[model samples]
Target chain A: MRKIKMIVEYDGSNYHGFQSQKNAHTIQDTIENALYKLTGHKIPIISAGRTDRGVHALGQVIAFETEAKIPSDKFYLALNSVLPEDIRILNSKEVETDFHPRFQAIKKQYSYYIYTKDSGKTFLRKFAWCNSEPLNIDDMIKACKQFEGRHNFLSFCSSGSSVKTFERTIEVCQLQQKNAYLKFDIKANGFLYNMARIIVGTVVDVGRGKIKVNDINDIIKARDRNAAGSTAPPQGLYLMYVEY
Target chain B: MRKIKMIVEYDGSNYHGFQSQKNAHTIQDTIENALYKLTGHKIPIISAGRTDRGVHALGQVIAFETEAKIPSDKFYLALNSVLPEDIRILNSKEVETDFHPRFQAIKKQYSYYIYTKDSGKTFLRKFAWCNSEPLNIDDMIKACKQFEGRHNFLSFCSSGSSVKTFERTIEVCQLQQKNAYLKFDIKANGFLYNMARIIVGTVVDVGRGKIKVNDINDIIKARDRNAAGSTAPPQGLYLMYVEY
Candidate 1:
């Protein structure tokens, strides 16, 4: 069996999540069903990360074993022909038999977009979070800087995640303003469940002057979910890249 | 009674269209219902343009008469509170008694976004037209320039529109590209039904070398619907702004 690695893109609005569950539609189930149609085998695929419901991914990575005779370049086109318009295979390549997309991933990048206008634009309503309140970009940036290092990010992550360790390295964290949108670009070695959304929520509170910038360290030290800001909505989070 | 003009935004994926039709969910009908809930009377709103099904808008302008005593600034917040998350009133102000959103509009700007990547990102799937092909952007720019001046766009218009004259002045037409997305920003005194989409489709053909740059002028001169390219999908077209 050859290991096939693929770059996948999906609109997660109508999906239960990335994981396959009984009686629930999910991105994984959709692609796996399409693969079953193509290869005539139900091959379970592994993803770099599991996205929650209503969360989206632009370049999500996945891998699966297949005995089909098709070439690597033909995998993307063949799978895409059977996939729905909302889900697509961006690229495909062959990988080592021992390679795992999730375990071997060195870093992952995610972007959270916020339409900061007094009202949201029509097309972006389903994708970006709309907040009419004035957000202090400077304060948000200052708070974001505090998160740019290795720390036990227990407070920033939601409870009930299967992760055993809260320690993770955040290599880069940035807040950028473009036109009427504020985008958060974050890169980390690993992330816990709903970590990025909780980070954004905490920073948003800082921008709204509800929390002090230095409070981020204390929250991280507290290792408590309730110590952080409320979890930001799922529509704003996007998995941008997974580096192997 | 005071005439109030509103700049509205809505996701049209779930609506029939802009105009109110029997037994169908239209953007106009939804907003009117919200208005009726706020005031105890029915008020008909006139829109600057009527967008087709699955089309979205950012700066669509509508005007209605109301005898309510709410402050003008409060109109934005009050209406937003009652409106669904998919539709929002971005701005509201009192206009001249003679001001008509449809009749007195000086110019309108519309943009068509095309996702020309091998595959589109998940979050943008609903808002952008997904076309999988590498096209020459320079050729599109050259052909798009021919549409910048006053011209009779009869050929680009859809059939069944009852406008007497097809002559319209185009103040600006620009084709801009970023990464995998290409946007055509076109401003004109008025657009024929499906004119923007047809124009975008025709330009995309030019970009793909399916049509010559000079063929745009010839097509316009033909003044026949068959002379234009296929009507692009409605989701890609956005009513950007209107000046009254």
Candidate 2:
């Protein structure tokens, strides 16, 4: 058997999520079906991240074992032929049998988009969030800087997540405005359930003058859900890339 | 009574076309419904162009008379509140009673988009054409220049189009590449049925190395429908702007 590593991209608007669930339409389920059609394998496909509903991905990594003799480059074309138009395989290669996407990943980066104007309402409505209010980008950028470095991000995570620890290290967080949109990039060792959305909500509140930039210190120290801002919507977040 | 002239943008994936048709969803019908909901006026909307099915619009102009008490500036927010997410009125202002979207227009511009890569299948799939083959954009740009100036474009016009004449002057035909996409912009005094699509198809043929850049001259002189290339798909075309 040969171990195959794949880099995938997807538009996740209509999918339940990246993880496979019983009786639910998902990205993993779709890929498995395509794999079964190509290689007749009923095995699991492991991914680096299990993104939430309506969350997009640019370079999501996956690994699986196959006994088929098809070449690595040909799998990209064969899988795309059967996969839906929203899901595509960007690259495929053979790896060692012990390779694991999650354990080997050193960092992951994500992006969130916000559309602030009604003028440029082209076909991007599905990819970005539309917030009608004017935002103070200077304040939002300042708040984003506070999210850098290590922190116990318990308040930034969802309430019911069953995780071993609430501590994680953030490598970088930068915000930039492009035309009518506000885009932010965040890189971390690991993320909790809805952590990115919660952080964006808190920073957007800073942009709106509801929460001061310095107040982020108290919110992180509290480590309580109610102390942080509300969770933003899911459609705006994207799993941008993973570093090994 | 005030004649309101508005600049509109839309994603035309789900609509039959820009013009209102019997028992069909259209951009005009959607905007008219929003107008009725706001001002209680059931009036016809006159547009600068009647785009085909799956054809989008960026700065499509429309004119209609209204007696609503709402100010012109606030109409943008009011209409957007009720309009579907795909359609938007970017600008609205009261114009002279004699101003017309079609008759007063000096020129119209259109754009066509083609995606050349197989990776990163995202929301843009609904807005562009995917061609897997490698394209020669430099050759295509040379062919684009041949399409400029005044010409009797009977061969480029679709059959069964009842027009008084087949003569139109082209101001520009420019091609550019952005990442994995090839985009072309065209400006003209007027267009016949499927004229823009047929021109795009011809230009794409040159890029694919199927036709010579010099063959366009003979094709134009033949005045036969069989001399020109097939009409490109409607989804790749956009009515970019109307200059009035």
Candidate 3:
């Protein structure tokens, strides 16, 4: 048996999410199905994180144990041949048997894209959040500084998450404006359920004047989900990469 | 009655082309239905050009005569409310009553995008053509100069097209590479059925060494559909705009 790690890219708009369900189609299920067809393995492949429905990924990481004789480099080509067009294996390699995608991951990067009413990127609707008005970029950028460093991000996490703790270190939080789009890029040691999305929502609210920028400190200190702004829609959130 | 002209954008993946047909969900029918709901007019819209199935458009022009009380600018918002998410009216204005979208159009700009195997833009599979090997962009750009200026484009048009004349003036033809994407932008006075796609296919063939760059002039002069390379797929083609 050999352990393998793969970087995957997927347009998650058509998927129900990352985790497999009984009837719905999920990214995890689609990849597992393809893997079964290729290697006849039935075990669940471990992922760095489980994404919500409609959330896309650029460099999502996954690991699995297999005994197939295929070479490491050929694995991506083989998997991509059998996988759907929306999901592709970007790269693959053999890893140590003890490697765990989640536990061994040091940091993760995510990006959120927003299209305001003034922009006309209609084809990117599935990959971006479309709002009625353009968010104030200046205010959003200022509020991003509040998210830097370690914090108990329970206020940014969704309810029903049974994690042991909400403490996470945000290494970077940036807002970039390119033409008609506002992109939010964030890097963190680890994220709670929907933490990145909630942070985006809070920043957007700050830009919209619905939430004060200084109030972000209190929201993190409160450690209450209701203390933060609403969780942004899943479509705009992207799992950019995982650093191991 | 007012002649309303609108610049529209759409993701053509789900559409059965730009023309209306029985038992098909076309962009034309969808827009007509939305217009009918917004206004009581059941008249069909006239478009600058009819796009085949799965061909996208960023600034497709359409015109229709309406007696609705809604202002010209407000029509876009009202129609978009009833239209599908993939289709959007970018702009609307009042046009001359006798102006015909096709007959009065002077030029049109179209682009074809190719995602090379090296790029991980797998998310754009539905909107671009993906190829494994890298295409020779330098040779392709050189061949583009041969396409500039007026010529009989019969060889570059698909069969079964019965146009009055095959002469069309090519204003510009350029192939540009950005990262892993190859974009072919062309401006022409007019195009025959699948003309732009056939031209792109020939250019791609030239890049692959299947056809010589110097052979393009002879192919255009042949005035035979068989003289050109195969027609490229529709998904990669985008109608950028129509100049009136």
Candidate 4:
């Protein structure tokens, strides 16, 4: 069997997530079904990240083994032809047998978008979280700085995550505004379960004056899930990239 | 009775169109229902434009007569509190009794987006039309210039429009590239049915080298619907703004 690597893009609105679940629609299941139809082979597809329901992805990488007769370049077109309009195979190429999408991923970048306009039209509601309340950017920026270095993010993670290690290094944490939107771009070697969402929730709390900027450090030191902010909604989060 | 002008935003995915259709979901129906819940009166809403199914709107303007006791400035919050998540009232204020959303409108702007990237992520699928081939912007710009000013746009309108006059003034027509996305923003005094979408479809043909730039004038002169390009999908078209 030959291993093939692909870049994927999808609308997560109708999907349960990236992984397979019984009776639920998933990005993996749709792509795998499409691949099976194209090559008449049942292949196991692995992704770099398993995004939650309603969370979108761009540059998401996936790898699968196949014995199809088509060349590597043709796989992109072939798979895209069979995929749904909401899902797309961006690029496809032959990869070394040992190459695994998740195992080989060295870093991941995620972006969270919030529309701070007093009102947004219906068109942008799904892609962004509309916050009519004016947020304090200075206070939020100060709170975000506390998450820049290595730390145990257990307090920021949601419960039911099976990760054994909660300690991870954040390479970069940057926030900026564009037009009426505020974007949070965070890069790290690894992230714990719901870490980015919880981070945003905490930052929003700071913006709302519910928590002080320095409260971030105190929350992290507590190592308790309840000590951090609530989990922000999934609509605003996007998996921007994965480096392998 | 007070005439209130509202700047509305809505996702058209679930609606038949902006108008109230028989036994179909519509933006008008949704907003009217919400307004009825807020004020126990059946208020008729007049809008600046009527968008098709799967279309989206940002700054659509509407006006309605209501006897509700809510403050004019608080209309945005009051209506939004009762509206569904897909629809939002961005701004509201008391308008003169003579102010009518459709008749008093000075201009309207619409934008069509195309994804010309070879591959794209999942997040932008609903917001743009994905084309595998790269577009020729130079050719498209030349074609767009031919469409400016007042002329008979009969060839560019949708199939079922019954408007008597086909003359409309195109105030602004421009195209821009944002990352891997190509967007066309056009402003006009009025549109003849699906004029913006048809213009986008024809220009896209020029960008794809399927049609010559000079053919736009011929299509306009021909005054036959078949002479123009295909009607683009509704998903990529947005009612950007409606001005009074």
Docking class of 2: medium
Best by DockQ: 3
- How high is the lDDT of residue B54 in model 4? 83
What DockQ, between 0 and 1, does each candidate earn? Answer: 0.57, 0.61, 0.67, 0.63
lDDT of 1 at A173: 92
Evaluate candidate 1 and give its CAPRI docking class based on DockQ: medium
Positional deviation of residue A167's Cα in model 3 after best superposition, in angstroms: 1.0
Q: Model 3 residue B157 lDDT?
A: 80
Each prediction's total of clashing residue pairs, residues at least 3 apart in sequence or on different chains, is: 0, 0, 0, 5
Predicted chain B of candidate 3, TM-score versus the true chain B: 0.97
Q: For candidate 1, write residues A1-244 as lDDT tens digits.
A: 9999999988887899899999999999999999999999999999999999989899899999999988987899999999998888888999999999999999999999999776445556657887768878999999999999999998988878887899999999999999998999999999999999999999999999999998888998999998999899998888999998
Residue A207 CA error for candidate 2 (Å)?
A: 2.4
Q: What i-RMS does every model get? A: 2.1, 1.7, 1.6, 2.1
Shares of reference contacts reproduced by the candidates, in order, are 0.67, 0.67, 0.70, 0.83
Candidate 3 clashes between residue pairs 3 or more apart in a chain or in different chains: none
* Residues A1-244 of candidate 3: C-alpha lDDT, one tens digit per residue: 8899999999999999998899999999999999999988785799999999999999899999888889987899999989998898988999999999999999999999997754456777888888767567788999999999999898998987889988999999999987667899999999999999999999999999999989999989998888899888999999999999
RMSD after Cα superposition, model 2: 2.8
The positional error of residue A98 in candidate 2, measured at the CA in angstroms, is: 4.0
